[model samples]
Target: MKTKRVMIASEEVEYDIIRSSRRTVALYIRPGGSLLIRAPWYVPAYVLLKFVESKAPWISRHRDKLKEIRPDQPSTMINAGDKIPFMGRELTVRAHENSRNGIYVIEDEIHVSVYGALTPEKITAFIDNWYLKEARNYFAERTQELVRLHGNILPVPSSVSIRKMKRRWGTCRSNGAILFNRELIKKDKELIDSVIIHELCHLVHHNHGKEFYALLESIIPDYRQRRRNLRNL
Candidate 1:
């Protein structure tokens, strides 16, 4: 990888390059604070440097945004005062007396009555289980409809699965198994459907080439708007 160092905000920063044919130079910070600079394949080093200088403010702002969106909840443990997002709302974790019910979904909270002592690790595990169960049921039915509509043209096999992925919302596996992001259940139903269609279309054309986009447009005329809306999630 081609790499270089530049100064930003009085700090000297080094970044790796991924040269592409795209006209713009994009910069991003990784979780470890390392920066990445993707520039036009044939752009000169001086030109790329100028682009980076012009976008320093925007880059700094976006880096902060990424940090804000990072989910620290995954490692957090559940307890009496732990706050969690149940459905779309935030709820404080409350442990009540153990009931016949393994987990209870109250008006706007998750009431977990444990038979024994509670730990943060256990709480996080229980919450993840709850999310997986609900997500599997929700995404399974939605994926089926998209398959029914376009399964014939799918390049891979027809089975589908839904998962919770931190980086991507959906992916079409080479084996024809379509995996959807479980977190999508938190979004509106229409946006969920758009994500489903987007991944399903990928089964027909693997790459985002002209033909792939054409196929997607034919299936979903308003895809661009739905896509833009989904990104707001």
Candidate 2:
């Protein structure tokens, strides 16, 4: 991959072209803010540049998504006898031959009883699935609680739904169908609650205006902290 300079709106928007075996051209921005253009090994530089130029609008639109990019935190495997943090404290996972396939949060650690030795990737996959299941349950209960608490002040009667969104943590639809990012499962429970609460506030005010923020502040006092912690996760 090599970077080539290009001018956009009087600012230098760099274009990186990565040579690959397949015949394709795709552009992306790394989490660290580096721009990339992936293309086939045989594709010419001029052709790739033209494609990028045509997709400039798309590039800019995706830049907003890049703003949400946070540095990766160190992660370890959720293996046997390994302790991992949930909301704040650590839980130790203990694998037992007689135990069933499940995860339990014990004092100071989470216990995962696996049947056999698994790779870190496989363990993470299991943990992620477990969290997603838990998130669905938690969100359903909490959304109902919020509706009961603030429905009187909200502008519309909305329903909450869960889905795996790539670019957004949560979105409030005009019809009031709130959607949450499935990635939230990777974080702790408190962070997940914060995201839920944030979306619930949107039920009252759709936009991030002064009234919306004011209401959110009243409902979730430490929303900013929650936002920060979520980004860190």
Candidate 3:
């Protein structure tokens, strides 16, 4: 991976370039306004730079939108009354001290009960662990349902796994395995399903070519809209 700078729309944009064995040139604007370009190893540097220059307007628009939606500095500490994003809704965090440690959600609040003094670290850990468990169960069941619903067009995944990923919502490996970012569990089901369907389509079409998107559109007619909604998040 190499970092490069380019002039896009008169703005000096810095981006990371990662060349892989993959066959396509893909651009990703990650959260917090970072730019990443994934290209085939055979593509020349000049070609990649020209490609970035060509997408100047798109880069500028999406980058500005991302910066606007994302906070300049997100707080790292979790405290009572703090709002947490869950299933596309902001749920208030409520802390309690009890004889036993436990956590649950009620309506729009996450009630966290700790056996001892409440600390920011403990609260963060409890919430993260809870999200992980929920992501595993939710993604597994939902993936199965989607596969069953679209069995004629979708392929059953070799396996489904979840983890915290910085830049990707979900990915489909060459071996037919699907891995989803645990953070996706924070989004609404519609966005989650969009990612699942996108990866499931990959099981049939391994690349992001015309046929792949054609299949995707056949299943989710508004996938483009879903992607736009997700980028806003």
Candidate 4:
């Protein structure tokens, strides 16, 4: 394997080149945004560079999508001035000592009022609770809206629930239950809708066969572009 770098659309992209007895050249964006190219041993370096350049648009799109869906680093400590992601934007955190213990949002800041000592743990707890409450209401409403908009083609989920999932945005069980990851609240509604619609399609077709995607595309024609990370799931 040889590592090479090229400028695609003015962006520097580093890719690994693996040559074998394979008959064709292929490009892939591996997990974490690494690029890989496979080609026959007889292919020249210039030819490979041209091939990578030809795929500039596809490369750029997938890389940008990967960045959008990348997992954020968990906060070890929460403090005033810390930024928190909500609905695809960052909101600054403002901690205050007050007689009432509560949380509210004003403009671009999340105001946390604590009656007792203001600690990182307290702030984290308050923020997590707020996210969960908001996610529960938002996901449920959106799921219902999508189902109604799609008419009878989509099945109504028996129940809609929210939890913290490590690897998935949502899941549709064979029993008709749909569960969404509470962390999904951090993403924009477009991506959220894609997950909801994907699960809803699963209600009609349990597996990811051609029939399932056919139904999904009928509902969200641009689903692949909207939910790039979902393709892997």
Best by TM-score: 3
Ranking by lDDT: 3, 4, 1, 2
Local distance difference test scores for all models: 0.69, 0.65, 0.86, 0.82
RMSD of 3: 15.7
The collision pairs in model 4 are none
Looking at candidate 4, the ten consecutive residues that score lowest on lDDT are 66-75
How do the residues 94-186 of candidate 3 rate in per-residue lDDT, one tens digit apiece?
Answer: 999875567889999999987567777568767877898889999999999999999999989999999778899999999999999999999
Q: What TM-score does model 2 achieve against the real structure? A: 0.54
Instruction: Count clashes in each candidate, considering only residues at least 3 apart in sequence or on different chains.
Output: 1, 5, 0, 0
lDDT: worst 10-residue window of model 3: 66-75
TM-score of each: 0.54, 0.54, 0.67, 0.65
Off by over 4 Å in 2: 1-76, 98-100, 116-122, 154-159, 165-167, 183-191
Per-residue lDDT for 86-176 in model 1, tens only? 4456777766644221565776677765434455644555566667777788788767766777767644336767766888889988887
Q: Give the TM-score of candidate 4.
A: 0.65
Off by over 4 Å in 4: 1-75, 229-233
